[model samples]
Target: MHVLVTGAARGIGAAVVAACRAKQHRVTACDIDASALAGVYAEREGVDCVALDVADAGSWDSVLAEVWARQPVDALINVAGVLRAGVTGELDPADVALQLNVNVRGVIYGTDAAARLMRGRGSGHIVNIGSTSCLFAVPGNGVYSASKHAVRGFTIAAAGDLRSHGLNVSLVCPGAVKTDMLEQQRGDDRAALTFEGKRALDASEVADVIVDHVLVKKPLETYLPGGDQWKGKLCTVLPEVFLSSVEKSREKGIRNFKSPQH
Candidate 1:
């Protein structure tokens, strides 16, 4: 399978590229940072790197043309994302818009373009990387949470729309993972996040879940560590009470994070 993965320079995207390579799948990894992409792959075959920003339409079209020229893309994974810390009172609208542009609009563009190609050939899979934050109301990161929720909504709708046309769609919602994104968020309130100061899951774990689900042809939505899947469901079913409690917990947690920023 010829697979195209974005934001593949580090973290879960990198891990996913590695996993697909191990499975003997042809992978094209793209990222805006050339050094980040270069540092990871010493000598990788069946994998080529492209420096492309997902938020730019012209850049995406150019990259997609390059990808198509090399090989027909059998699968496209939209893993590019940004994490921001902000609340309604202290957040910049531009930051929030940037988050949506990268996290939501990026997925939309990739999915739409890939789906059009796959529909003509009658085969393809599109996997979107979302966060467990979509499941609940994260206190200071309300904007980030909302962006992910949009991803989830789009993934579900894409699944329904693409099924009849012989296309596959799945949303990979991973919990906390060890990555630079979280490190950059040190000062921000992490109280609203699941598992305080505890290592949740690694990028490799998330990659495994994503690859396994894709191979098995699972449903449009797949939540990693299905055991905690109920929490997201509960959050959806009881948004008012659940979100109120989460906000309270986040306020309490931020208090501990004031001086040290941990």
Candidate 2:
């Protein structure tokens, strides 16, 4: 299958690109960080990289055109995103806008572009990367949660809108992945994930599952390592209890949101 993955420089996106290439599927990777993309898999068989800033609509169009010029895209994975942590009082308008623009608007643009191509082909899958934050709003990371919630909402609506035309949509929710992003958070004064909590996830593992599902069921959403399974089930069945547990966990350092020294 011909696949295009945004934010493919490293972390989940890079892992997914490698996995797809291992499967012998043609893969195109786009990211704003050209250096990071260059550091990743070289121009190997079935793998290509391009500079892409998902927040820019024109970049999306240019990359899509470039990919189509090579081969028809079968899957478009919207994996590029940004996150920030702040309560209402501490929230920086600029940070909030960055999150909203990149995390929310970026997905909207990608969704629209992917839907157009997928609908025309009458066969394709569009996967949007969501987060567990979409379920429970963290205290300091409300903006991050809001952006991810937007993703969750958009995925559901897009699923309905595209289903009649043979297009598939899935939201991939990953919990506490170990990545450069996580590393950056470690030093930030308002981080939501700590080293201990970060141990639970490996980006490559999540990427493997993504490749598996997109090739198989192409379901509405797939959570990495079954995070959505238990998380969603508990949140739905016992919201108050789950939320209370989260609060208790935070208090007990089960999930640390405090910053670590560099």
Candidate 3:
């Protein structure tokens, strides 16, 4: 299969690229950081590296066109996202825009572009990387959570809309991951709730689920830890109660964030 992955410079995106390559899939690895992307995959065989800003619709158009011209893409994984931690009332306007642009709009643009091409071919898979935050709103990361909520809704709708055209659209919502993003949350009170998980997931663990299960099963929605789905569902069904409980847990999460274990 020919796969195109955004945010391939590091974290889960990079792990997904490696996982796909291990399965012998031809991959086009893309990231906003061209130099970093090149440093990681330029020397690797069966992988083509490209620079892309997933937030720009025009960039998606041109990038997908160029890639398709060389080889039809059998799969597209939209993993590029940004998180800016702050209370909603105090968040920088620029930070809010950045999160909405890169996380929500980026996923929409990439999925729409890829679906068009895949529709014509009559078969393809599109995966969007979401977060457990999509299920429950986090205090300091409200905007990021909202963005993933949009992604979750969009991917599910897209799955139904595209299934008739032989396209599979999936949303993978993982809990806090041990990436640079997680590291950035350290020492930030606003992001304390993000550290509440017992243990952060390795990027490869999320990547493995995508490559091994999502791609094969083509499920519309998947939660990385499996247990998170129930937690998310419970939170949604009892937001008032859950919010209070979650608030109480924030201190523990903060301790986890500062602890050596994290």
Which candidate comes out best when scored by TM-score?
3
- The clash number for model 2 is 0
Candidate 3 has an lDDT of: 0.92
Order candidates by lDDT, high to low: 3, 1, 2
Q: Best-fitting candidate, measured by lDDT?
A: 3
Clashes of each: 0, 0, 0
Instruction: Show the colliding residue pairs in model 2.
Output: none
Model 2 accuracy (lDDT, Cα): 0.79
Across 1-262, the per-residue lDDT of candidate 2 in tens digits comes to 8889998988889899988988888988888998888778675667888898898888888889878888989998988988766768878999999999999989999989878877886988899998777675656677988898889999999999999999888988887777776766664445533332434477888888889766578878776556555766577578787666654455433345442421
Rank order (by TM-score, best first): 3, 1, 2
After superposition, the stretches of candidate 3 with alpha carbons farther than 4 Å from their true spots are none
Candidate 1, lDDT over the whole model: 0.80
Number of residue pairs clashing in candidate 1, backbone atoms closer than 3 angstroms, sequence gap of 3 or more or interchain: 0
Q: For residues 109-132, could you state the per-residue lDDT of candidate 3 as single tens digits?
A: 999999999999799999999999
What TM-score does model 1 achieve against the real structure? Answer: 0.90
Give the worst 10-residue stretch by lDDT in candidate 2.
253-262
Candidate 3 contains a number of clashing pairs equal to 0
